[model samples]
Target: MDFFELVNRRESVRGYLDKPVEREKIEKIIEAGRVAPSACNAQPWKFVVVNDKAIVSQVARKLYDPLISGINKFALTSPVFIVVVAESRNLASKMGKLVKKKDYTNIDIGGACENICLAATELGLGTCIMGWFKEKGIKNILSIPSNKEVTLVISLGYYEDKEPRKKVRKDIKEIMSYNNY
Candidate 1:
């Protein structure tokens, strides 16, 4: 499929099938993220892949919340997860962050994460980028460092629903301008 088609097809897959993603496909997805552009060449990110059934189940527990009526329950059906972690950035990126008063690390990480998702879609796999997971619980379960921060938990597998929902987006006129806003 073409890039536009792939992007259109890449939606947040909530319901996953009872199948596992291939190891090679997972590696390729990570490779796509690894090559993504970063601010001042500082990757400032690490992906902790949880593919082992037992470990994936443990991580899923942290995603479920009884407080929320219907939130993150689909994590239980996910066969894999790629936990995005924030790491130490380079000196130039740090300086830029201080000067610009904006955290470029997260922005760079978002690009990488998107690349991962696109790669997964190309591989005929499904992915959902989740930010509502329990960070501390995930950290403890994965033995992550005390200083490291978990940014996102992306669930991955074959989707139970094969169709991509129609995208609802702003019109071109509302979001675009000729030369000025």
Candidate 2:
């Protein structure tokens, strides 16, 4: 698909089919993320792709709240969970963050995550980048080091619903300016 069409097609898929995503497709999605540009080329990101049903269930447990109805319940049905981890920043990225007063790690990881989602969309798969999850639980389950942090969890699979949802967004005129805001 064209870039514009891919962008339009990409959405947060909450429901997924029972079928598992192919490993080859998953690897390509990860490759896309791996090549994503980072601040100062500081690719401080690690991805844990959980395909095992048992491990996926364990990861999904961190996203659910039995007491709260409809709280990330859709995650349970996803066939794969890609845990995005933010590793410790290198010296250059650290200095850049301090000088610019910006969280470069978060920004870099965001780009990588976007790449993962876009790649998945291109591969005829669906993805949902989830921020609402138990970070500590996930880190423990994945055996992530204490220094590195769990950035986000992307649920991946085939969309259960065939209908396409319309995209809602601000117009270019409203969101863009010629030279200045």
Candidate 3:
């Protein structure tokens, strides 16, 4: 698929088929994230792919909004999830962060997460990048170290609905300014 088309087609899929995602495709998705660039070559990201049915359920349990009911309930239909973990940046990146007064770790992780999603879209898998999950619950379920941050959880699988939903967005002219804000 064309890159533009792929980007447009990639949506936060809330529903997925019952079929399992292939392991090869999952690996390819992670490979895309692995090759993503980060500040000072920090590469501060780890992807925990959870394709096991039992674990997927456990993770799903943590996705709903406790303050409300039925929010993120669609996650129950997802067959797989790739948990994006934020790792420590390299010394150079850390110094840069200090000097620039900006933390690049989360920014770097965002790029990697996008890469993972785009790769999945290219390989005929649907994905939803979730930030509304319970981070502590995910850490415990995945055996992730307490120090590591669960930045995002991505639901992945074949879409139950193959049709692409039209994307709503701010107009280009409103969003872009070439030389001035």
RMSD of each candidate relative to the true structure: 1.1, 1.4, 1.2
Q: Residue by residue across 20-73, what tens digits does model 2's lDDT show?
A: 899999999999999999988999999999999999999999987676785889
Ranked candidates (lDDT, high to low): 1, 2, 3
Error of 3 at 144 (Å): 1.0
Q: For candidate 1, lDDT tens digit of each residue in 117-142?
A: 99999988899999998999999999
Per-candidate Cα lDDT values, in order, are 0.93, 0.91, 0.90
Better of 1 and 2 by TM-score: 1
- Positional deviation of 88 in candidate 2, in angstroms? 1.5
How much is 63 displaced in model 2, in angstroms?
0.9
Weakest 10 consecutive residues, lDDT, candidate 2?
159-168
Ranking of all candidate structures by their TM-score, best first: 1, 3, 2
Better of 1 and 3 by TM-score: 1
Model 1 Cα shift for residue 117 (angstroms)? 0.6
Using TM-score, give the best candidate's number.
1
Candidate 3 structure quality by residue, lDDT tens digits, 1-181: 9999999988998888999999999999999999999999899988899999999999998986656677788899899999889888899999998999999888899999999999999999999998898899999999999988899899999986567888999999998998889
Which clashing pairs does model 3 show? Answer: none
* Model 3 global lDDT (CA atoms, 0 to 1): 0.90
Off by over 4 Å in 1: none
